[model samples]
Target: MTVPSSGLRSPEARRFLNDRLDWNLLRTFLVIGQEGSLSRAAARLHLSQPAISQALKRLEEQLQVSLVIRRGPRISLSSAGQEVLQIAAELYGTVSRLGPALEEPAETVTGRVHLLSISRIQSRCYDDFLARFHQDYPQVELEVDVLRSSDVISALLQKTASFGLSLCRTPQPRLEQRLVLQQRYAFFCGRRHRLFGRKHLNLADLQSENFVSFTSDQLGGNLSPLTVFRDQQGFTGRIVASSASLDEILRLVDCGFGIGCLPEHIVAADVQAGKMWRLPPGDGVSDVNVYLLWNREQKHTQAEALFLERFEHMLLTTELGERF
Candidate 1:
């Protein structure tokens, strides 16, 4: 809380303000402001909506100012509320660092680093870093879950994941994102497709061919580049199938569902094994970047910090071309 120069100058007044303010109330208000809804903040904190409302009311009553303007079901911060939100965030950030600051360096820092990811990440640099990090920090338990790109972003926002590796189309306001890998995509077909054995084919040859792609392959979705590429090619065929899982998309394409755009490097084995064939426009394929994401406002443990530091160091030292 920010006090005027003459407001809390007396020790008694300072003690009164400090003793009356509840830290939990500040935390609840911060979440409410971040989420922009009492219900969403309650869900994030695993508390009831009435409880969250009561906390906000108590804090407002203590400060003698309405912190939020509620209309219908949504809520927005008032002018005073915005100032309090900033102070609360600063106070919370300071308090969150206290644990890490007080703890001395030990032989082993034991904690779990929960990582979320998109499916079938194919990178030599990522694999090598994982191997090295595991060897260096044996005591830190690592838990990973594969999810859709949207789900990965959601988990990071909810502070449920320590970090994520996924495709990103735009920047998120509350998260720190770093480009970790760039993957090239190409059109491919299964052996059952009519164009499988063609040797001399151009982009015009596949004009009316049916297409299959990821669920997020839309103009404003996570795979927007693929959508733009398809629109530019003037393909008249409809999307016959789509899936969120890369393996499922590959399987659908391989089963004659339709031609699909997939990462060239990841499907190299399938291309060689006769399961899939590369289509036209092989040399000038679109590249999508994979980002490392984490919530900037979330408190991180020493283990998570160490892992982030090591991974960031690797990214800084390695070349972009070498990541693939």
Candidate 2:
């Protein structure tokens, strides 16, 4: 049997991976070890003699553990090889049933799963996603929350949600992540503002204006995206107001409160509806990304697993892979 690499089995202190071990090779190993001959093992498996030998060789290379003693006609297992075979046989028992365990019975899908997001604009995806989730898993319930950027990590850690989405720039050991989209920040002014229809405004144009921003406590950093807004091409702006709520910020921006920094996706619809417009390219703030986060130790509940499965399929098939 092809034993998985492990600190206990290897000469070095490294853990084994599920992908590295080959089950078919282990079956060949078991047969070869039993018959004590390659030709005989090959006959039992109905494989070519060369195939039997190659399988054993690949296993040895992967484990960094020699598994056999070979001569022209005689074959025997090394002591280390014998130990591996015994351990591998036990591991094989579980590996064999893994497929059947997940096959599942055919029935209506039902389960409760929770999801959390960093911003309201991203959470908007859930309105349609949940309606569809219910159609598939009619009895399933999905709870969604929109929290600040920093709270996404905290929510996952505290087990308050099964999935989290946010702008996670650095890796955190406690969580696993999958990239959903890269975000670019944009500047927008209220429809009532004088610059509403103004185009081609340079960084210098924004230098003398006040801006609205996310509070540091909400953004999880010393500086908000305002840093990007204020420093673009050395343009400096005054902070007129700061709050964590995107909806409130957008409304205030609509009410002629102040110019603001926002994700393009967040303001795209409004821009399309002619409620707001983007500033000139070089003067624009940038550098933001959105990621899906979760704790690996606790996998998705049945409902969440199916939701993720469908969501992943949607991304794979659509051109909109970057945003969701």
Output the number of the lDDT-best candidate: 1
TM values, all candidates: 0.67, 0.60
Question: Candidate 2 versus the native: TM-score?
Answer: 0.60
Candidate 1 residue runs with Cα over 4 Å from true position: 1-107
User: Least lDDT summed over 10 consecutive residues: which range in candidate 1?
Assistant: 1-10
Error of 1 at 227 (Å): 1.1
Tens-place lDDT per residue, model 1, 16-81, is 878888998998888787667998788667799999999998887667677888899998888888
What lDDT would candidate 1 get against the real structure? 0.85
Report every candidate's CA lDDT.
Answer: 0.85, 0.68
CA deviation > 4 Å runs, candidate 2: 1-108, 122-131, 216-229, 319-324
Best by TM-score: 1
Sum up the clashes in candidate 1: 0
Instruction: Spell out the clash pairs found in candidate 2.
Output: 2-26
